[model samples]
Structures are given as structure tokens and as C-alpha cells.
Target: MKDPKRADFRGPLVDRRALLVAGLAPLAFPGPARAEPSPAPFPFGVACGDPTSDGFVIWTRLALDPLAADGLGGLSAPTTVRWEIAADEAFRHIVLTGEATALSDNAHAVKIEVQGLAAGRPWWYRFMALGHRSAVGRAATAPDAGAATESLKLVAASCSHWETGYFSAYRHMAASDADLTLLLGDYIYEYSYVGERAAGRPRRHDRAADVVDLAGYRNRYGLYKTDPDLQALHAARPCVVTWDDHEVENDYGGLLSQDVAEDPGFPARRQAAYQAFFEHMPIRRASLSDPWRLYRRLAWGDLARIHVLDGRQYRSPAACATATSRRGSVVGDDCLERLQPERSMLGLTQEDWLYQGLGGPSARWTIIAQDLLAASIRQKGRNGVVGHWTDGWDGYPATRDRLLSAIRNSPAQNPVLLGGDIHSFWTTDLKADFADPESATVATEFVTGSITADPPPYAPFAEMLPENPHVKYFESRAHGFMSIAMTPDRMLTDYRAISDRRDPRATVSTLRTFAVESGRAGAVAA
Candidate 1:
């Protein structure tokens, strides 16, 4: 890429090192096809994520037809690709260059974790393969640890179920000037649409069988990757990601399936989903062989620290699940299992790690970037119902209390949480005890709605807010991402919502704005 003529080449450019992995293609899946291949294989586009102070990951997939039926992405052979990271969009100052193998075993995807560069700066990257070059993408590195950080602008998004709506939210996000994006899971849904929902489906899976196996999961991911808005979001910013239940099976816990506790195939299916997610995403060294990992931390100098927590893989099973009827969603007095003290969401080890991270007065902004929420939301009728939601932190009250106590006991300055998964915007004051209105407000939780998934009903959730005083704001009817702009003094959160999900030319506007002042725990209107 040093040559001016080669640098001027637009479209896809396969790296020279791709050939090294190319010769060994036969050892991978799909074997080596003698048949002629397509000229351009970047069907799924390019992405970058999991950034650090020194480096970040770049990703691309070789797919002739992203929605191909067999979920092979029309790849009959392994392919080679080259990647480069530049200081500018014009590729003037090339920093890192490398080759990666797009193996069929990984669904023809390539992920190269590039390192050893300056921190807190913007970078551009692209992929080349088969004489064609993929589109250019932008990513940013975290600032050096213990260094002075003035401000950070981040975009938070989640719960993008493909069939429900269009991804205009992602399009808007991709066009934004945010430094990074955080995808709070539900990246892909595992259920098939039926009845009227199927009739009005915006998109359909390649093969809609609820994704039980490897092929099914791969096809599902391929189907979602075909969206231009989603692709643009991936290309526009480096992201910190963690998974929730929808990526595997709906409402699934660590050691148990959503319903039946002893489904032997659940682990294999989950492993396939995990592998497929790792293949598609630009995450670095994500564990597919383990069940209890993916919880880690990323720092942005002394200004901010992001704790990406995985609440799905280590949590105890939902309360009140039984054979023949395993509905563990609703809260009620009948479910004694929900109040078990041993129930955990982040498991014991991860919980302790999180506590330690929040124990000290370190970064000016200690942001908890997790998938599930911690607010105590209840449903209400004329009697004002108070149900214990076992799916989120409300289900594991003991652990939630422990975390809140840690934040309160710690000398940390500004403790804030950016969360997604409920598919509705929320600005709640996180307290140690939901029952005690006078309990100290330990920290703040700002939850964003879905990118394209269906908007949740507003009225019922609205009724419950009166009883739950800790909730400062709530909106259940919207589809968009949240933008968080944080400085050392205060963090401002804007709930950016799109006008319509189906419209290709939808406009984005802020639904509300909330701010948590530095040295303060609760959030107030900005």
C-alpha cells in the first residue's frame, strides 16, 4: 500500500500476506473449490472494535452472497485479505499493515487485532481481497492510562431485531461524530416471526428455524449483516460489545436454557452462537470455548473507564421456572425462588472484579457498560402491583445490593452506567434498596432503547413509575440510540430517537436529556 498507485486503488484490495493463508485453505472448511470465484467478496462489509490505548481490531468477511441459503455465504473456498490502519482517511501516514485469513471455518471472516500505536487518536482502515478493496472505516484508540482526559463522546445502542424494523438508527449513528459505540447485545434475535408479525416483517432470515445449530446461527448473523445501516455503524466507530440472551436463546441463563434446565444441546447451540458472534464482530480474542468469560475493562486515560460486563453467561437461572411451564418473566408473591440470596447475575468472580474496579477514586468517569439493566421496574394496576422482575438485576437483588454498596463505599468520583436490553429508554437513579425511598442513591443508570426493534408499550410501564420513585425518567415508545457526552465535571446523556423505523430516510431527534454531575450519584435533567 506504500505505492501511490496501489494506495489510490478504490474498492477491495487483497493483501499480499493473504496468500500465506490462502495456500492452506484446503485444511479449512468448504475445502478448496476449483470453480471460479466472484471478483468482489466483501458482501458483509467491514467493521472495527475492542479498542485499547495502543491498538484496535479490524474485521471483514468474504461473502459473495450474504443471504445465501446454505449459510456458506457463497464461499466454496478459504480466502486471503490484507488490512491497513492509517492516521488519516487519505492513507498518508500508514501506521499498521497486516494480512488475515478469511477461513470458511470462521464463515470467511477476518479479525486482526492491530497494536503498538499512539493513543487517543482517530484512525482509518480498510480490507483488500481478490484484487478488490472494501470500504474504509473509522476507529479510535483509548487514551493512555493515568493520563489526563478532558472529555469523551460515546454512542450506546442495542436490541436490533432484524425482522421487526429497519436500521435507520444505525445509519444516523454511523454518520455521527462520536468517538466510539457500545453495542449492549441482542445483536441478533433467535426467534422466528409468525402470524401478523411475520406478515409485516421488514426482513426475513435465510432459513427461519429459530437457529438451533451452527449453520442456523451463521445464517442468522449473515442475514443481519446484510443491512447497510448496521454495516455503516460497525464501520464508523470502534465499539465495546457484550452479549445478552437473545444472541443465543431467548432468556437463557448460564448453566440452563430458558425453560428446560437440562437441555443437553443447549451448550452446543450456545457455543455455536458464541463462535458465530466472534466471527462476525471485530472483537479481540473473544472466548468461544468457555462459558464464563467476556467480562473485562477498557480505560480511556484518567477521564473514563468502561467496564464491559457479561450478565448472561454467568447468571443463575430465572426464578419460578418449572417443567411443562417455564415462564420466569412475571413478578409475583408466589415465586419464592426469586428471592434466593445465592442467585447471581455477574457470578461471584466477575462481581468481585467489578467491585474492585469501582472501589477506588480513580478515573473521573467510571462508566459501567453492560447489557442488562439494574433498575427496579414494576407493573401496576388499580392496586399498584409490585412484582419482582427476575430477568434483570431485580431478579438477583442480593448481588445488585452488593454492587450498589460497593459504589457507595468506594471513593470513586462519578459512577455511571450505560445500559441497553429492555428496548426502551430509561433514566433511573440506582439505589441500594428499591423498597426504601430514603436509601442512598449510590450511582446512576442510563438505559437506551432498541436500534430497530419494536417499541415497547408505554402506559403500563408508566403506571409503575409512580411506585418506583428511584426512576427519574422512562419512555417505552421509541427506537434509536443514546449519545453520552462526558466531561470531568458532569456527564450528559441525550436520548436520540428516530422519527420512524420503517422509513429509509428517517430523521433523528433527542427525546430527552439527563445529566449526572461529578461527585453526585443520581441523574437530573440537564
Candidate 2:
């Protein structure tokens, strides 16, 4: 029997007796850090992300009016912003301080990369500008590259639509004892309205139409950032983020738009969206030089190595895409075009880099974080034909095979894949050959559900489960996040479910728990 008191990540992995374990500390800031002033200079709050052993990037935008019509955060002239990092919540034990200029060119956002700090320790930070002080944010650096550590705790979430519901998942994450947070993708949606009942939405979007230019994209991000729960989540834990299709357009691939006729204008629009994303996110400043580059790796001592991937920027047009129809479609499994070896998902350069890293010196655990599901979900299509979704890995069979082969042949140990953008929870065994149900399982996969977005109809998806033996579990009727705790011996994953998205103070419970023992390539119910 499972111990109910120690079910959640906070209760078991983080001990209440001794809150601070080595460099990992619980979410405990001073009282002032929890409150944000209305219509204040830093209304959007503060964030820190992209952590390294030395230091991490800290961010804050001077937005007295975040929803301004011009998308400038209501700042006309450049302002100098000061930042400080301290060992304690108060500024008495200051370790580092610096000044940065927030200008209209970058939407009045100040992002600083602080170096020379102690590795693997917690730091408290805050900003000052426009005669007002921002909320104090808590951040932590990574453990040294190859150092041995006891365990790592992580929280993962994605697919947040502002008009659909509230962000209670982010609120709960802010109060947890997680060392790092992973935002897989779909951080913001382009459309002002999605699906039916647009007029009766729980919340209204900031724009009246779909976003097209830099101004529109910046405003969309501003609208999402202004949410109190999202702000609190950023202020609580450091996040590592990447983008999916909704950041540009629905189901778009590379330079192609949803419809082929709009391909002519897709380039300019994509460039604008990329620029806006960089300006608002807590990513490194070095990424601005080559905005298209996002795939990177981070090491968590000898316990784990996280390989973050970019799946949208360099993918080929969806297989069998037509000029008059959709960008991605459900095609029969017999479709020959999707099986072509030339159809690349991560493009050539990214594929080479990933293959090289997968074969490098081994870590105790290898975690691959990307934007979409890597497992096959074949189902019955119209006219009694088996089909696959062309927008995901099912469309590029050759690419998936090569990736699985590399993992099977590499020295990496206990590989596990993490994904989002499906708006549903899933646990599957990644087999060397998905076509053969009895084939060897090479790795395990866990795809998180949406934070607030609507899920696809559950009945239809549930009916197709028997055909997929590799899929261990599936659930589509909830809104929440995943809590993962990894040790050298085993990995424990909890599928946390929120009771209600419409409620501001919704309660979260563990809907299910699964465990994968060391050297095991499949998840078993715990």
C-alpha cells in the first residue's frame, strides 16, 4: 500500500523536518515577495530561467500598463533598472548587483545574465525602476556538471489558453518544492477565439483577431504574463522553456502557413513572432544573435542530463499537405509519402547534433524534452482504414526509427522522454519497433496534459487504446501538471489532477502514480 501522506512530490522527496537539503530549498521567500502592486511599474512581476552552474538569467519588464495598445509596456523613454542578488531574502547579504537599460526596442524588458555566483545554491533577487520595487524572485543554479547528487525534483506544464480557463496548475507549482520547471510549448495562442462558444468564453482575449505582426505577438504575451498565477509561478521557480506551433500558427511547419496560399507572408510573420518571444522570455541573451537556435542540453550533476529539442522551427511541411486543404491531416497508414526517408522532423543539423550527444559519455539518466509526443498512436480512420496523425512523429517514421536506433545503440543509461502539446496525459513504452507489439522497449515516455486548454473528445481516443499495446495509460478529462522525482535507483511520476479550472483556488490530487525501476524501460503502476 502507498502512504497517502507521502504521495505527492513535496511530501516524500522534500522532507518537512529539514527544509533545505544541500542547495535545493523549499519555496520560502519573505512575505513581501508574494504581493504585487496593481498598476505598478513591474506589474508583470519577475522571472529567472536558463540556469547554469555559475549563475542564471534574471528578467523583469517595466510595464506600468502591460495591455497598452502599442505593445510598448507603456514606456516611451529608456529607463535604467537596477538588480541585486543576495543569499538571504533581505539585501543585507548582497552578493551581486548590476544595472541594465530597459528600452522600447525590446519592449522595455530588462534581462541580465549574472555570473561568478556559487554553484548549486539558492539566490533571492529583485529589481528597482521607475521609483517602484518589483517582487522578490527565487532562483537556483544547477549542480556542477559531473558531480554526484542524491535526487532531482521537477514540475512540467504546457498548453495554456487564456480564454479557456484559469491557471490553477501554475499556482500550485509555485507552492511546491521543485528545483526546476519545464515549459514544453504552446506558451501563448495566436487566435483570439478557438472552437465554439467564442462569445461565452470564461475570459476574453486581448486582441480581436489572430496575431500577425510583432506588435500583436508582444501584446499576446503581455496578456498571458499579467495573470497573477503565472507571475507567481515565474517568481517562485526557474523555468526552461521552448515553443510549439501555437506560438506561430496552428499546425504550421517551417516556413509554410496553415494554408499554402498564405506561404508568401509566413516568413515575415514568423520572424516577428520569434523576435517577440525572445524579448519577453527569460532565455539567454546570446540566443538573440541566432533567434532560430533553441535546442540545447543541461546537466544535473551525475543524476541526469536534459536534452531540450526544437521540433517546430525546422520541420518539413506535413506529409501530403495540399494547397486547398489543411497543413496536417489524418492519412491512411499505407500512405507512401510519409514513409520517405527524406522527410526530416528536426532537420539535418539538429539531427546530427542530437545523435552525437546521445552516443556520448553516459549519465545515470537521460531525459529528452521536446514539444510533441514521440510515440505512435495509430487509430481507425474513415472507411475502416488505419491512419496516423501527420503533425507528430507518426508522420516521419524514418526519423523516429533513426532516433530509437541511436538510443538503443548508445551508452546512455535509462533514457526517458518528456513531451507536451497533446492536451492529454499519456504513459507509453517506446519500442524499437512500434509496428511489432512484442518488440523490445528501448525507453519510456510521459506526455503531460494541457494546463487549461480544451482536450479532444475522450470517447473517441479511448476506443482506440486496444490497438496500441505499448500505451500504458491515457486520460483526457482534467487540467493539471506532472510532478516527477528522479533518483539513481528509480523514477516516480505523479499525474496530478486539478478539480476545476474555473475555480481560482482549485485543489489538486494525484489521479495516478507510476514508477520505473533502474534499468527498466517501461512504467508500472505504483
Candidate 3:
């Protein structure tokens, strides 16, 4: 249903201005004639991530003298990419410079992992290629070993549906002072439907309809990157990203497509999606694969260890047939009966790897950066029958239970699960026995809300939360990200909400603050 040959931009491409009342140029215009906007050296903007105390990765895409939308941009020959890191925004004290080649094979994107730097310091970076300059970006390194960090702040967010609304939440996040961003998943959706019913409104960009091939997926990512808010967010902070079901196809696993019988070439389609995903993301080369690598760990000295997991690639199929199932009925007796211990979300190899990482971690906090809700949530549906999203951790009950038990029994200190994907926000106390209301808490989970995606109305979910005892807080309406501050004694999370999505300059507000003490696994209102 999507036209691959079409240009990236749709509709009229022109900037309009309102005339000034005082017989002068509009307020949008400058006071006098100035130099033309320079062709950016790094047209795709700048990004920094995968930070360690010694060094961090700096990234930029070269697009000097870019050509028009025939998919031809810049020179076909490999270009020499150069970058510099400065102690100030003005580049007065340039400290590091490096040269890397941007090849045609990877769309001229340059990712340089600069090492040998001062730990726990802020740095500004920029790129140079083909006689143009990139927009300056800011990045920070982690604290050194045995350093007693007073606090560390990070923003966690996910589930951005571009067609539903603007990415105003990202704009707010870009302006914030968070050191890093943990993007949980649903970076892009892969379905096409006619009329307003598909997105519940008329679509903006049409190329995203049922992305199958590499180009289709690339174009979809390009469309999302074009959003100023999203670009600004990427340019500002170091982001640790992972994918959810929507990145490839909703509720898909391995070779299984959404409608397996209807689409037999799902394996090939998945490969294409994975390739495109690797190309656009700021992930390291080691993570690239024909299928894709899903698990990795990032360390921040003795303070924290972030364990990133891939939930969709090697996961089991959804347990229910209904479009929307409540907690109890979602994973019916038959489905629950079929959940074997061997049925894995992170395959055997990844499981072993995760356990090894967990065992070696002695940080103040072991944060699991994952895609779905780790806690069990049950709610009564309209038919007065209880249901659940069998697609989440609830589907693989045994595996979830094992993982919880591992955390409880492991040497890892203060395990906290950070997730996104349901679009709604939730805070829960993870326990070994969720069936028992007063069960001992083993861990804590904070499920951040979506960036722009519309969560289900608040009224229904609000009424349902009271019945679920483990759930500490739940909100279904707002669209924003979570700001988490971690310390030796406690971890504080602020649920920041955007005032509105329709407006570009929407202000962000802290909706709630919750904290989990060092020894306590449950979160208390801050």
C-alpha cells in the first residue's frame, strides 16, 4: 500500500510568514540581511552515547551539498570525516580531534568512539566533512572507579506514534539536563490501514504503510528523524535504545509474522527491518547481525549497571486471540499450561549472558532496561471478565518468575526494572508471589508513559488500578518521559508530563515522584 518511489516530504514545501503591523518585515525575519544558512557538515545532526568513564561515542552523518530527493545525496566517493571535542560550547578549548572515513556502504554516517578523556566531565563536539560544520552537541562521561557519585539523572521513554501526534515530549527532553536517555522501544510501527481507522485519523507520511523491505524501513526511520523535536533530543543527550514489537511487526517472534498464514516471507521481512534498524541507530558494530543482537550491558562505574534486553526477537507468541484482553483471561488456562521453562524471551545464550552480568554487578543499582511491563497487572474488561496483555512478561510467567527469583537470590544490589510499551505509565512492586497480595517485594518497576502515543482513556484504567494491589501508581492520559535520579541510598523517579501534544511549545510538568530505598524493593511516594 506504500509507494517506495515517492519523495520523503509530502504536500506543499514552502515557508509562510505573517506580515508585521508596523510596515516592517514579519517578526520571523532578521533585523538586517545576514549570511545564508550554511550547508551543515553533519546534516543528520549529532549524537553521543555508550558512555564510560574514560570515553564515549560521538556520531554524525555527512551530507554536504546534498542533492534533491532522488535518494542521491553528496558524493558517491568515500569522504574523510573529522571531529573535535571541546570543553566549551564555543570550541575555545578544543581537546580531541579524530579522522574517520565515511563510506558509501553505510550512508556516510560516521560514528567514532573517542577514548582517553577525563571522567565525569561535560564535553561539546562537532564534525567537519566536505567544508561544512555540524551542529554542536553536548555529552558527559561517567564517573571513575570507586568515585562516590552524589547522583546521576537519566530520562527513560518509549512508544512514539508519529501519526497520532507531534513529538513535543522529545523537545522537552532535549532541553532537560539528563545525562542519558533510555529509549525502551516502539521506535516505529509497521502496519498500514485505510481510511482514518488505522491511526484513528488521516496519516501524515504515507511511506510507512506496511514497511517490508530495507528501503521502506529506512524511509520510515528518515521520516521520524525529520521531526525537529526528535532530532533535538538525539542531538542533546546520549541515548541507550532497544526495540519493542512495533519496530518490526506487532506481536511477532522469530519468523512468525502477525498473520503468519498470510505472510510467508516474514523471515526476510524481519531481516530487512533489522538491517534498517541497525543502520539508523547509534548502536555499536558488534550488535549488527542478519537476525540482530538483543542483549548488552552498560556500566557506570560503581554506581549503576544498565542491562538492556531485547524482548521481541526471540520471544514467544502472544497467548490470546482477542485484540484487547484483560489480565486474568488474556493468558487463558490453555496458554499458561503451554508456557514451558524452555520457552524463552531472551534465548538460552542471552539468558546465560544476562545471569553472568547480574552475578558480576556490585553497583548500587542494577537497572534492567527492557521493553514490556515486568509486573503482573490484572483488570476487568467491559464484559466484566478479567483479562491481561498476554504479550507482556505475563505471557511467559515461568520465565518472569525465574528472572525475579534470580534477582532476589543474586548478588546484584537493588534490582529495578525500567520499561515502556503499554503506552500507559505504571509503578509496581515486583514480588516472587504476585498471587499473594502481601507478598515480599523482590524488585521495583517504573513503566514510563509514551512520548506521543495515545494511551487508553484514564477513567477505565484509573478505576481498574485500585483492584490491582501491587500497582502503586498508574496514569493513562499524559504523554511524556521519566527522569530518574540514582544514588547509593535511594533511586528517585520523576514522571514528567507534557502539557499537550498538539502545541509545539507545550510545557513539561512533573506529575509524580516516587523513590525506592537501598534495602527496600518497593517504591514509596516521594
Candidate 4:
């Protein structure tokens, strides 16, 4: 007798004997598998990340009921999930097939690091479990290390607050012709509201209270993953992800909490947040074992070398912070602690690792992917005094100087910095000395605007622009992302903005375009 819970799927099927003959046997999973075929097995959809020349990591979570209060995705026992990767969209040519166990402990999430595949091309993938199949996703492997390549297209986005507006930018990003995506930070917010939803807010978070425990964080991620546009964007392009403050808590630094300086439960809360983040994200197993291993490097042939940095975990506390509020604060030039040389943002260890190789000799373009803006920005604090925000690179001047010196002294060519987290778009010239306009420009920095988060008031931000001559362009009224394309000769970037973030069916347009030529230090209008 057939199991009534299992539904019939007429999709393509692979022969078990043929797979064994090709030495592509599925991995052995123990225990009797409990099937959840009713509410669809893959409710959160599919995602792939951390692409290498040979393979990439593909992920999916089996959710019978995604919004269950237990944060287990309505699963009580272990289940076996089968995955396949094909060279074409149709399943006619299967390259690899494998099976994995989805245990309830980790929310039934499966992350498989596929290997031994061809490089520099796209591959189609899908997941199967108990007569149900997931949506087909597209992923590609990077070109061989040091291999000559022509061009690479990348999309950079950040700060999508679900309660504020719709994720229409992700829908447009999914339709873009890009090879890779970088989700810089603030993927999910930690705040949870009560009573009726706020005015001008499109939606509310899933959990009823703030996320301080493991279950709360898990449910929050579940809610964000349910967004169809976000799922589509993940399925379309292989992503490289890193987190900012909201992934754990707002403006948290090192082992200190932002709200209360000496919160006793902060360590456990941070651990739970890290565990939930690893379980949901498509990162490798190395990140799970070593929590601080988020900083790494990836090579896309000889064209570019992407150096991803983690600036949150091991940093010194913000300078000039009060005893009660330990994260970030605006401090004027008179604050002596803000200019101390001992304060570091990336920690001494990561700073050493980042400065070691600097940039290799192979890649023509060196790309620095990080959380916050690296360039210095001065804004009016109070009483007409000029101050710097301590949450970003400006707070750690010594570390920033060391980083800039490393880039200037290394063999790295045509270095470009990509950043987010200010909720505004900025194109600035990274100078050796921001105090002097005639100082040498070291590199060009492009800061992507938020996807849905509210921006700071533009009038004040614009009023201080004259004080910052290195700032080529600054716009705070738009909500969009940056589309970057790079070749051996030059890199072109387009600031793509949406008409309205409140409307789900918003239209997208290019607000501006800029280019950085080979061996150039600043960006120019393209």
C-alpha cells in the first residue's frame, strides 16, 4: 500500500542502477526516514554559495510547517534528502547525485559541498525528498585559479528591513545577468513588535518579541527566507555572505552588548545567534567549527581576487562609548580616545592575516568586500561641531591607515573597495590623508545603498558634503543596489534604484554609472 502522505510528482526521475554504475551513489543515511510531503519539503527554497573552481555549496531545509513555534520546521525525526546537479536545466544529463540526512537538531537544514565538476560554467541543481521535489536553482563554479578570464558581473546589496518596506529590489536583482552576489550585512532585523503593525510598514516580523534566544533567531530567519523574491535571488546567483550588527544585535562590538554594557546573558545570546546563522546560511562547515573563520579569500581567475573581511566579531569596543551604551556614538575631534593608535576594528589577528599576503601577483583587480565604509566621512554632531561616527572605519584611524598603507605598498593592482551599512550610496576617493584635498588618492570606494532600510535625512548629509571634497557623489533618497562589472582593463558600476520600495511591483532604473580604469586611483563618470 502506498503512503497517503506521499504526493505524486511527474518530474524527471533518475535510474538508481545507472547512478551506481557511474560511481555516483548517494551517501548512506541511517535510521528510518520520516517524510513530510504535505506542506512541501522545501519551504525556504534553495541556495548555493562559496563557489570554488571545482565546486560549490548547495543548501536546502525541509520544512513541513515553516512557522511552527518550536523552530524545528515541523519536523520531529530525521529525514533523508536527495540532491542532484546537472549540466543543463533539464535533468537529461545528470552529473552528480547524493543523499543527505536532515536532522531536527539543526532545523533540518542540508548543506552539501559538491566537488569534482568543471569550472567557469553554470550548473542546475534541485532537491528531492519523499516524492516531493524542490525548485530548480542555478549555480556556477569559478574559473580555475590564475586562469585568464574576460569579465565578471557582480551584484552587491545590503540592509533589507522587512517591516519597513517590500523586497522589490531582490526581484529585480534576481533578473539581472550577474555571475555572483555579495550580501554584505543586516540580512535580518532582531527587533519584534507587538499590537497592530506600525503605519507605513509593509509587514511585521514573525516572532512576537526581540530575538535573544536560539528559537527566536531561528524563527526570524524562517520568516525572511519565506520571502519569494529573496528565495528567487538566492536561487539565481551563487552568493558570498557576511553579517553586520543586526545578525546578532544592534551595534554589538566584540563581547559587549549595545543596550546594556554588562548584560550577563550576552555571551549565550551571541552563541545562539551564531549557531542559528550558520544553520540557515549556505556557508561551509569550517565556519561552524571556527566561529571567527568568516574572513577568507576567493579567486575568480586572473581578473580579480575577492578578499572578504569580518569586522564585527573580534573588534575593540567603540571609542568614546559610555558605560551604559557600548557600541557606537558620535565623538568630536576633541575625544582623545577616538584617535588612539591601539584601538583596532578587525582585531589584531585578522589585521595581521589581511596584511600578510595583501594582494597576490596573479589577479589584475583586487576587490575588498567588507561590512562598513572604509573612507572617512565627517558630519555635524551638535553645536556646529564636526564629528565622526564611531561604528565604521573612521573610529579606528590607525587600523585604517595600516590597511591603506598595505594596499599602497603591495603588488595589488587596481584595488576597489565595496561596502554597505550606512543606508546611503556614496562614491568617494580613498585618500592617504582626508584632511588635505591635495593628498594622494590610494583607491576608489563604492558604497551600496540599503535595499529597504530608511536612510538618514539628506539635507544634513548634503550640507556637509562641501567639507568632504573627496566625496565624488552622495545620494540618500534612493533605495537600491550596485551592479558591478569588471574586466582586465576597467571596472564599471551602475547604481540601480527602484521607483518605490513600498510597491511590490516596482520598476528599476539606473541612477548613475561610474568607471575605474586600470591603474587609476579614483572613479569618474562613465
Per-prediction TM-score to the true structure, in the order listed: 0.89, 0.91, 0.86, 0.92
Tell me how far the alpha carbon of residue 414 in candidate 4 is from the true structure, in angstroms, after superposition. 0.9
Q: In lDDT terms, how accurate is model 1?
A: 0.79
Worst 10 residues of 3 by lDDT: 18-27
Give me the displacement of residue 380 in model 1, in angstroms: 4.4
> How much is the lDDT of residue 216 in candidate 4?
84
Clash counts per candidate, in order, are 11, 0, 4, 0
Error of 1 at 456 (Å): 2.8
Evaluation by TM-score, superior candidate among 1 and 4:
4
Rank order by lDDT, top first?
Answer: 4, 2, 1, 3
Candidate 1 error regions (>4 Å): 1-39, 286-292, 380-385
> Candidate 3 has which clashing residue pairs, if any?
326-387, 326-388, 327-387, 327-388
For residues 1-526, what per-residue lDDT tens digits would candidate 3 score against the true structure?
6544323323321123311111222122122211222436555577787777666777766654333232224546899766777656666556666567887666676777665566777777777776667777887768776577777789999998877778889988888888898899998776655465555542365453677776567667766766778879988877888999778887776567766463579888888888767767776554435337857888777888889998878765555544432222354345554367767766667777788888984788899999988898776556665655566777777778778878877999999999998888899999889889888899999999998776877787777776688999998888899999988898999999999876677899999999999988899999
**TM-score of decoy 3:** 0.86
Q: What's the lDDT for residue 519 in model 4?
A: 87
User: In model 4, how large is the Cα lDDT of residue 259?
Assistant: 67
Q: Which prediction has more favorable TM-score, 1 or 2?
A: 2
Q: How many clashes would you count in candidate 2?
A: 0
Winning candidate number (lDDT)? 4
Cα lDDT, all candidates: 0.79, 0.84, 0.74, 0.84
